[model samples]
Target: MEIAPGIYSMTQRKGAYVHAFLLDDGDGLTLVDTLYDTDAHRVLAELDQIGKSVSDIKHIVMTHCHRSHLGGLALLKERSGAPVYAHQWEADLIAGERKQQPVAWRPYAPVRVWPLQIALNLGVARHPPATVDHFVQEGDQVGPLRVVACPGHSPGHLSFWWEQRRLLIAGDAICTWPSLMLGWRGFTLNPTQHRASVRRLAEFDSQILCVGHGEPLASDAAQAIRAALPSLDR
Candidate 1:
């Protein structure tokens, strides 16, 4: 689905309707995440439908190293030969040098995620490891995105802002799945950091919002994010 001009949102049933975005800034395609398929068939289909090929994917950017988002990283990187960019904190994990830091096993408000939390704690269902070619920090530009370091979901969690389009690519910092939320409580490593991150995300005058999970918010995106701010307190 084209959530906005030049931005296409791709979703998968696995990983709680996990989403990835394909961005065309005219230079070439820049993929936000790879979705929840190891073969990357879904993403490839989307590209084919748009008459684009893997080589057109000039940059592949990662929001974090979570398994749900990393499934197609290796395949896409190998096919597109695009340099992968992520935060420094997630480099080792992305490279398979270390497993992701686990989250609490206890059930939180969105109990549906408990199973996933348990899977992470047990280090099960790992994704194919891929190398990160570059480490991006806040203010750094990757394609048309301005990297925003929004930790708390994990130490190196990131979000992206496209000032040109007033778009915010909020990874797990905010979720619209099950319902709009300030990230899943059970998986949140640091509530304080997540809270601050959401607060900062809400400040963006985003007219469109794309998240790590759930459908893209096409309108009143900033207003919706601000409205969900009180959830951070709970």
Candidate 2:
């Protein structure tokens, strides 16, 4: 789905479904997050749907360091030769400085049964660490998008917000699902920090909320976030 004029959300299936945004900056396309390695072909196929090729992806921006988010980095780098951009703190994880942690979920979570969930957590033990071509801090600009630091899911988690366009690419800062569901079931490095990140996002006036795991919220996104604030406090 085209979220804006040149921005598109490529929804892909892994353990659970996930969405990665594609932004065309006229020079080349910028991929928000790379899908899982196993789903690379599917992702490439989806890119084809928009008349884009893997080689057309000039920059790979990671929202965080989760394997599900960076699993396809090696393959994408092999194909696109694009510089991978990530937060300085996450650069080590992305570059193999720190070991990628195992994915663990509460036994009562909804997606444990899915084979990909186990595979992603256990099967892919190590991610191919790559160097960051560009390290971004909060308030930096990537093309026309502004970088916003919202670290809670990971120490270096970041989101891209296009203030002029009222577009926000929130990387798991907040999800369409309930906070408890995400805390107990979804992937999070730190729940306390995540809550803070959510609160920080509320301060920004955004028209769209593009999360890593659900459909994009196009209407009253800021209000929706305000309503979800109480849940985070609990």
Candidate 3:
């Protein structure tokens, strides 16, 4: 999905399913989030479909430090030698300065427990231990993308915004999947912070929302977020 002229959403096929975005900045590509190791080959395949090779990726901006989001970083970095950018807080966790925690809003059903844990242990549900090359604060500019600090899901969680196109690449700040109404379960540092971040994002007049899960929204993204707010409490 095209969040703007050069941005494209690259969804990974996983049990929970995750998405990453690609930004073709006229010169090269900037990847927003790299899927898990299990999905690394798929990400490479997708890149091939777009006429890009792994080596063509110049930079990678991580939305947060989650296994599903940063699992393939080591492999991708080895292939492309691209620099990884992340918020300072997340950078700490990714770099082993802090211990990673589980998400808070997991579904109550018992069916997913063991399998989820297995995936986590196998490095398919969380990021493989690694380091970031660049630590970003709230207002950092990544090529043409602007980093919007949206912490709540994690201390350093962030979203990317393209002011020129009114596009927002919301990582897990908001998910499009209705099944994850309460927000992504398994590991969330703070629910209250996450909600506040969502509200903050709603204030932005973005025309497109390319979230981490579910379908992408075109135009009136703020309205869609408003409509989803009520269900978040369910």
Best by lDDT: 1
Location of the lowest summed lDDT over 10 successive residues in candidate 3: 104-113
Name every residue pair that clashes in candidate 2. Answer: none
Off by over 4 Å in 1: none
Clashes of each: 0, 0, 11
Q: Indicate the residue-level lDDT of 124 in model 3.
A: 39
Q: What are the per-residue Cα lDDT tens digits for candidate 3 across 1-234?
A: 565577777665563567887888787888888775544776787788888898889888889877667777777877889998998878877765665664433354233433654455454334556678999978899876899998877888889898887888888877766443435644446777877777788788888888776667877887777767775455
Query: Estimated TM-score per prediction?
Result: 0.98, 0.83, 0.84
lDDT of 1 by residue, 1-234 (tens): 787889999999888889999999999999998988899999999999899999999999999988899999999999999999999999889889997798997999688988889988898888889999999999999999999989999989999999999999999998889899879999899989889988999999999999998888998999999988877786
Q: How close is candidate 3 to the true structure, as a TM-score?
A: 0.84
Runs with alpha carbons beyond 4 Å of true place in candidate 2: 101-125, 177-186
Candidate 1 minimal-lDDT segment of 10 residues: 225-234
The whole-model C-alpha lDDT of candidate 1 against the native structure comes to 0.92
Q: Pick the candidate with the highest TM-score.
A: 1
